[model samples]
Target chain A: MKDQKIVIIDYDAGNIQSVKYALERLGITPIVSKEEEVIRNADKVIFPGVGEAAWAMNSLRKNGLDLLIPQLTQPVLGICLGMQLMCESSEESNTKGLGIFPLEVKRFTNERKVPHMGWNQLEKLNGALFKGVVAMEFAYFVHSYYVPVSEDTLASCNYILDFSASLQKNNFYACQFHPEKSGAVGVQILKNFINL
Target chain B: MLSKRIIPCLDVKDGRTVKGVNFVDLRDAGDAVELAAYYAEQGADELVFLDITATHEKRKTLVELVQKVAKELNIPFTVGGGISTPEDVGVLLNAGADKVSINSSAVRNPNLISELASRFGSQCVVVAVDARFAAGKWEVYLNGGRLATGIDLFDWILEAERLGAGEILFTSMNHDGTKNGFANETLAKLSEMVNIPIIASGGAGNREHFADTFIEGKADAALAASVFHFKEIEIPSLKNYLKSKNIPVRI
Candidate 1:
C-alpha cells in the first residue's frame, strides 16, 4: 500500500507540474510521462489537463495517449480537461473524446459566470474517492466546461445547476475540479486514490 | 451553490514577502512560500502574489518563488506584477502559477489580451485594473495607481471581457488606503457591465467590508492585503463572519 507506483500522464498540457507537486505533498514522487509502457506499469495513473478540448485531444493523440488511456485497468484519476476528454464528446471545439465514460461536456450558459472559477462544495459524495471527506467540503475549481450530472457521477456540485464534480466507473475516476489545487479536500481525494 | 471567494494579497519583493505577516507559527516570516502556506492552512480561498521587484532578474526570482509556492501550497494562486508578454505568462504558468494578472501591459497593447486568451485559455487570464474616482467619474490608473490612463472603468472592463478575460480585479484607489470600505458603487456597476467574475480590491478594514462587497458591490471575490497580513482579520474568522451574514462562504 505504501510503495504504489504512481505515474501522471504528461502530454504538454497546462499545469501538469502542479499535479506532480500535489503528489509530492502526499510523499509520492509521481513520474510524469507520456510513454505507453511507463504508464501501463504504474499501479495508479493520474491523467491531468488544463487547456482547450480539441487542442488537448490533439496533444494526446500525438503522444498515442488517446488510444492507450481507455485500455488502462488501473485506479485512474482524471482532473478537469483530462476528465472531459475521457467522455464521449465535448461541446468545446465540437471534438470527440476517448469514450471511457458515457458522458458529455458542455459550455456553461450565460446565466452565470463562464469559467465557474472559485471554491464550491461537493454534494452527494460516494465511493472510496471521498473517504474521510466531510460533508459539503469546498474544493477549488477553474473551468468553462462541465460534465452534467449523469450515471457515473461519484460526486455532484451546483453552480449554474447540478453538474458532475466527480465521476466513477470501474477503476476510472475523474473530477471536473483541480484536486491538486483544491487544498486539503483535494489532498484527501488523492490520498484515497493512492490507498485504493 | 458556488461560495464567494476570500483572497489574500501578498506583496513579493526580491523573492520575499514585503508586507509584514503576523502568523506566529512561521519559522521564517519573510519567506513568501511559508507565508503562502500559512494563509492556505488558515482557510484562505486563494492567494495573489504581487511581485514588486523591478529588475532584469525579477522573472527568474519570481519564477522560482512561484515554483516553491506551488510545490508547498495546495490552494490556487495567481502571480501578478510586471507581467507583459505571452512568454512571461507562459513561464509563470509552466512553473505552476495557476493564473497570471496583467495590468499596464494590457493597457499598452490591447491585442495582448486576445493573444493570451487564445494561447492559454481564458480561464487563466486575469486582468487587474487599478482605478479611482476623479472628475466625477472612474478613471483607470496604471503603474501601481501612479499614472491615470484616462480610460473609463466601465468601458475598459467591457473591453477586457470581450477580449476573453476570465476575471477582473478592480482596485479602487480612492478606497484603498482609506480602509473604510470597498468601492461598492463602482464595483456593482462593473459587475453588472461585465459577464466575468469581479474581484473587489482596496479598502478592506473589517469583516463587514467583505460582506458589503459581496452584497452591495456584487463582487464574486474580495481581496485584501494588510487586513489579512497584518492579522487584523484572520481568514477562518472572517469566513465565519461572512457565513453568519448569509454571504455563502466556504468554511
Candidate 2:
C-alpha cells in the first residue's frame, strides 16, 4: 500500500510546524488542516498543540473539531495539549474534552514550576511509539498540565509527579512531549507512528 | 536513549558558509547543505545556522539556504540572526527550522519574545545572549557582539526566561574562538538561576572542556565552533569522554 496519509490537525495552538517538520523528516507528507475532509480521509491524524488548555480547547470547539477528532476511525496521534484534550476534562479551561481515554488533565501542583520544561526520561513504553526505543529514553517537554496515567497509559514521565507521556487506546495515540524536538529518538517514534 | 548531537554552526554571508576567528578574519566553509549532512552523519545531535549577513540584499538567499539544509538533514536544526519579527521566525521555521534563535532583536523589542512565545509557544523561541565582562560586570552585547546593551547578563537571562524563552544560548565573548574552555563559573551561575535549558558556547577547547561544562556549569548542552570545525574535538569522541566521566549523553 502507499504510505498512510498522515494529517496533522491545526487549530493554531502552536508546535504544528515542528510536528509537520518531524513527520516530513520521516518521509511522510503530513497535511496541516482544519478541513473536515482532509482529516476524515487521513489514515492517521496527529494533533499538535502548545498553549493554555482552555483556550486551545475553546479554539477546537469554535471550529467544531472537538467533535470531529474523537470520531476519527483511523489512528490519531495527539501531542502535548492535543493529548491533554483527549482526556475527560481539564483544569486549563474548565472545559470538557473528547473523553477518548479515561483520564483527567490537571495543573501541576504548585510545588514545582508551572511549565515543567526541558528533557525528561520516559518509561513503560507499552505501545507503538516505543516500538524499538530503549527504556528511559529522554524526550523534550514544555507544558503546565498533564494527563494522569490510566488503564490505556503507554508511556509516562516524572517531574513533580509521574504522568502519562504517551497514551494509546484502539485508534487513538497521543504524547505529552514534543517528539519533534527530542532528536533521533523522537524521529524514530514518528517513524513508528507512520509504520503503524 | 537519545543519540548524541554534533552540530555545525553555519555562519552565512552572501548565501555562503563563512568561518571567522574570534568573530573576525572571515573564511569560507563548505556548502551549507553538504556540510550539514556531513555533521549529521558524524553523529551531530542538531545543527545551528546563523545568518551573519542577514542584510537586505542577501535576505532571500538565507531562507533558500535553510530550505536546502532542511531537505538534506534528518536531525533537529535551529536558525538564528536578524530575526526581527514573528513573521521572520515563522518563515524560517516553515522553511524547515525546528527552532528560531533571536538575539539583538529581542533586546530591542522585548515584546517580540512574549508575542512569539504566545503564538508559537516558548519551546520554539531561543534567546541567544552574547555576554562580555565590562566595568566589573557581564553586559549583554548586540549586533553579533559589536554593541553593548548595558543589560546585566544574569538579569537578562532571568528576564528572558520569564518572558517565555524556551532556552538560553549563552556565548562568552571573552572565551569565543580562544580554544581554551567554557566559562564554567558564569555558566554555573546562570544554570543555577534559570529553569530553562542552557547551551554553553565559546571556549570549548578539548574533551575535558565538555565534561567541565556539564559537571561544573550544569549546562544541558555545550556548543563550540572552532573545536568542532578544525577537527580538534570530534563529536563522538567528546561524547565518549563525557560518558566516561559518568555524564549522561545520548550515544
Candidate No. with top lDDT = 1
Question: What tens digits encode model 2's per-residue C-alpha lDDT throughout A51-138?
Answer: 6677788899888998999998998888888898899998876878888887779888866444675567888888767888888877
Q: Report the Cα lDDT for residue A195, model 1.
A: 93
Q: Candidate 2: where are CA atoms >4 Å away?
A: A1-3, A21-27, A91-96, A106-120, A138-144, A159-161, A181-184, B1-8, B20-29
As a whole number from 0 to 100, the lDDT of residue A186 in candidate 1 is: 92
Clashes of each: 0, 7
TM-score against truth, every candidate: 0.98, 0.88
Question: lDDT of all the models against the reference?
Answer: 0.91, 0.80
Write the residue-wise lDDT of candidate 1 on B132-215 in tens digits.
Answer: 897798899999999988899888889999998989999999999788999999899888888899999999999999999999
> Using DockQ as the measure, which candidate wins?
1
Instruction: In model 2, state the lDDT of residue B205.
Output: 80
Instruction: Pull out the clashing pairs in model 2.
Output: A54-A93, B4-B250, B5-B44, B5-B45, B6-B44, B6-B45, B181-B203
Q: What local lDDT does model 2 show for residue A28? A: 73
Q: Which ten-residue region of model 1 chain B has the weakest summed lDDT?
A: B19-28
